[model samples]
Target: MHTTKRLTGAPGIYLLAANALVSTSAYALNTGTDLNLSMKPIAGGMAGAAYTNPQEVSAALFGNPATLTRFKSLHFELGAGLLEPNVDNTQTNDGYSHTSTSAARNYVVPDVAVSGEVLPGFVLAGGIGVDSGIGADYRTSPVNAGAGLGLGGAGAGGAATLPLVLELLSFSGNLGGAWEVTPDLSLGAALTVGFGLGQLGTTGSTTGLQGLSGNFGGTTSSVHNISLRGALGATYKVAPEWTLSTSIKSPLQYDYHSILSTTVNGYEQWQSVKVAQPLEVTWGVATDIVPNLLLEVDVAWKNWSSAALYQDIFQDQFLTMLGGQYTLDAWQFRAGYSYASSLLLNSPNGSLGGLDGVGTLPLNTAVPGVLARNDLTKVVQTTLAPVVWQNTLTVGLGYAFTQHFRLDGFGAYAFSENTSRSTLALGNYQVTASEWAIGAGANFSF
Candidate 1:
């Protein structure tokens, strides 16, 4: 068990901002382009976790393939977005010393897709999109005593300045079909593939202090990786306006290869890290409330059980997260909650937990003695924080400008907290984030 007081005492404002970005990205799991299937109107009532009802043309690729049988022609969709992150935080130790930092940044992303029926009972569809939609930049000044030589002290020993940043992007594709097994029941199958491109940047000061300013300077690095994924689904019509559905989104496997380049004593050196990706599954249902109005609800499960302690250079100390979604005609709404296990709090040397994963021990030891004492190297696990917990709510609306063209928009708000133990390093920390999405599409029949 973890005490709230111990988890709440460590004051770091930037952490609040970081949690927001993470929550927003997590909410994107049910409504954003990567998982939303561009069918917000049919996804408004229930959380976007359902695999049974594929009301919109775009969603058929991931939900129920049998939904494709309802289409008579060709359809296409496109979307783009922007996100902002802001943070304010401080850290203090047993001594009278402390440090605070705040930062904000913006991110922009885009998506596109198309689908069509090639035969009486056969349909073909494909799309391009992104995922893991979050990142951050943080810095702090006014070095403290715990950061250098005490219970929370930095092993490096000195007054210092710090800044860090990370980004992840995924490009994915889909191909599948909806077969009318019976007049009212349809079965579907699909294959999904996603490729990831990313970069990591860091810059800071370890000098201008008492004993350790001579070890480092500004540094930066970048890398790339790819992942493969797939899924299958089925839907049964119980009545003229009611449908039941279920789907299994195959797990993603990843191979990451990267290099870490930084300046030490003004000289450049390189290191490498690697890790494997986690797997996820979802199931749900949909019903027509009235003409042109549809409702959907879903429940999903993610498998972090396949997660391990150390496969290669990376360590998998964290476990799974859970979420849900709902949709209605012309409007879509979504909400989700999840618990994330911690990798930072478990590794002896802060090493990456899987193949191609990176380590943080060297980076953790980069600070001066005075500021090193209070440096938090590990976050002990407990029920309260159990690593990390995130919650989110999303809203979306769509309008048909014409019979062939339509427009859709979405907004989401999210928050997260990580309280692992009952100490200053084990206390509670929070973050909030918001996102806006807009899309346009056209449908034509032959």
Candidate 2:
């Protein structure tokens, strides 16, 4: 009821028809292949691991609240990014290979924020952006995947087809401020309202909903939800050339109304579900590696093993990021690298919870020979939403033309990675993913 009340107008309508998918494979695990693309709200040369040292206005606003005090005067930054993610899916069974490439590319990521001194000892900040997104499309595949989902080749012959189509995006808007606590230490916090929207469809196929025995696989569902979360951070200057900072972000949960369901005797039934993002803790440090060079490194941990939907097949994640900035008379150069451990640290082996309105049955103890009908569902899910990317490389540039204006640009590439899983239910499933993102922006400081 509360979610419906807030999402009733144009925003809801656009979310329903919005096809400009951002990036990733699943709701909880789609943190993107690069920092600027999904993990952070930054643009161009500012696209590095920055928390201890604020790279730009938007970075401090959304990254580390305590870092906001780094801005002595009014500073404004407006930037956007064009991202292209390439994903491929392949499933082989009984001498047939069904492969399709993701048609969802060219996503627009925005970064708009400002920070300024509202008082003599305190500073204020605000920003909004698309945090993370991921999706896949198999509708255009000529393979006519009809193996396990019913029709074409279900039980009549060779395995089944899984032309699943899915898209999910997480967005946020925030407002907060920081204080100059002493001369060397700063403390601040930020509160944000998070929004999650997504659609899962099998491209005209009826999926197994547990207890629905015949002609299954032709079902689709969409969910839109909102929740609250906040972050607390502190930054301290260790010396004239080094700074240290850390931030702790609370977990955000999105309650989906009727996101899953079953059917009975020609009628469809539905139930609610909740998928939550994990709590995150990060530590960063910046120091002058040389006279004109500044280096920053950030390390973080994500508690995915304790989250809702993520806990099923995901483990706690550990991530690391590194960046460098070089200053010349009127020009600056930047380079960054970021890596995140696989979210699928513990892969699911035909394990899933209960389908709403249906009884829960463990695959290891199900009526002896039925072979657990849910296995097909597990295969469908794994093939549809797999998280596999791990390494990202980036390079950036910055130029200051005057004391009040500056320009920045950057380019990044995510190396391709592949994985193959074998299960009796779906034979063999494979996924490969990589990405490219680039953008430019300008900043004004007064």
Q: Which candidate number maximizes TM-score?
A: 2
Task: Please estimate how well model 1 matches the true structure, expressed as its whole-model Cα lDDT.
Answer: 0.40
lDDT by residue for model 2 (341-408), tens: 98664345333333332112112222223233333333443445556767878788888889899888
TM-score, structure 1 vs. true: 0.65
lDDT (C-alpha, whole model) for all candidates: 0.40, 0.61
List candidate 1 stretches off by more than 4 Å. 1-50, 62-66, 85-89, 95-105, 139-159, 207-220, 261-269, 289-293, 307-351, 354-389, 415-446
lDDT of 1 by residue, 1-446 (tens): 11111111221323311111111111111001133432233232122433555435655665555576666477776655454433333333233333233243465545455677777766677766554443444434322212332222333332233344344455567677777778687777777676765444344643322222111223335566666666776677788777776666665544434334432332334443433244445555566655554555555554443532222112233222222333354443433332233332333232223211111112322223221211232211111012232344545555555556666555543344433211232122222223333333333333
**What would the TM-score be for candidate 2 when compared with the true structure?**
0.82
In angstroms, how far off is 368's CA in candidate 2?
Answer: 5.6
List TM-scores for all candidates, in order.
0.65, 0.82
Cα-based lDDT at residue 302, candidate 2: 87
